[model samples]
Target: MPSASLSVKGRISMINFNTMNLRQENNIRRRFIMKKAARFLVVILSMMFLWGCELALIGIGASVGVGTYKFIEGKLERPYPIELQKAWDATNTALTNLQISVSGSLLEGAKGNIEGVRKDGVTVYISLKDEGQKVTTIGVRVGTFGDRIEADLVHKEIAAAAGL
Candidate 1:
């Protein structure tokens, strides 16, 4: 029988089946979109967390390529294979070697901050964090914004002083 000539009950059932199918389709589409969005979010968050993670070999006089450091968000950071105390001492020696007069410094427990100014009057900030197991992470920032070259130079000095 033609759908148009179906009994009232039959017509209602047919309409309900179509409506159900549409609802199921919409739900499936929503789920697909949600899955894609979730995957995209995961990728973006991973990238953000690994922003300054670059592994480079450091020879006797190698530059900052694939070095044990990173420059992210105006901070050139690195995880040195040394303890906090040694890293702090290295930082001081590095500054002195570079003639960047230390204006202020604070070393407490496993964390430290050193503020200095280059000869040209550019402000420099360095932070040290202990990662346990005799590992320390150092972050360096130059000036209000960020100077990659200057930061690298600072890191080189620190690394040399630390004997890394």
Candidate 2:
């Protein structure tokens, strides 16, 4: 099969006529450069904002760790065993200040075990007493994903601390 072609000519106005003059070309180039600069500025500003947020978070963690430790020391009742009392004292010191102080207790028979719940920044893990009197083990389990103590993690932390 042979295809027949038809040819016609007029003013090719349908095509874009961009290469008219040097001034027009420069204007277009300037516009492109301005757009790119604006985009770069936006990106740099976004990065700076994120970096600032990260620094703020670190500062908060340090403040919480110190303040919570002090708060715990102030709250405990006297007359408990020296070792058990000291464990509580140390646990509070170790926690971040952002901790919500959900609930905590020391088990009767187990002198060293103590449990505590705190937000501790982003993730919520139940802090429990390890076998040793000095170290408090953080449970891998996460608490309820929200801002409350309804999560099963808190209950488990309490039970573990209470020696149940």
Candidate 3:
């Protein structure tokens, strides 16, 4: 038969073993939680990095677009006519292509003439007035060498006519 001291000692050892097992389980649980938290942080950081890249790209696109617009605007000059018909044709094209809609009388009254001679060419001066009796005012001037500078010239003329 075991002595009382031996029995008490055995019971204490068993209790200690159980306590160690419980501690091991708790440690495993803590490690699992830490791993999940780490993964969550990585995902969040990745998303933020992607968003930052997209914003940077958008900024670059806007800068490029603005630069292109300014460059085109710089190349444009007022249209000059070599002949009367050329001046009249340019003016008519500008009026026809106008974005704003006005009455027939207003369109009819929009007239242009080869006003002066410049070193580059003939300067065609176009005018628009409210001939519609309903108080409609529209006018634009387009200058071109009848070549590649047409679109920008048209835009400048329209903007000038609209007082923009």
The per-prediction CA RMSD against the true structure, in angstroms, equals 8.8, 15.0, 16.4
TM-score of each: 0.61, 0.25, 0.31
lDDT of 3: 0.42
lDDT by residue for model 1 (113-142), tens: 999999999999999998776777899999
Better of 1 and 3 by lDDT: 1
CA-RMSD of model 3: 16.4
lDDT of 1: 0.85
lDDT of each: 0.85, 0.40, 0.42
Ranking by TM-score: 1, 3, 2
Give the alpha carbon lDDT tens digit for every residue of 1-164 in model 2.
64364323323432234345666889999999999999999999998878746334323322322111111211211121124444454444444333545355444533434344555534443333333323233222334444333333343333334343
TM-score, candidate 3, is 0.31
- TM-score for candidate 1: 0.61
Give candidate 2's whole-model lDDT.
0.40
lDDT of 1 at 15: 97
Q: Which candidate leads in TM-score?
A: 1
Off by more than 4 A, model 3: 1-6, 55-164
Candidate 2's error at 93, in angstroms? 23
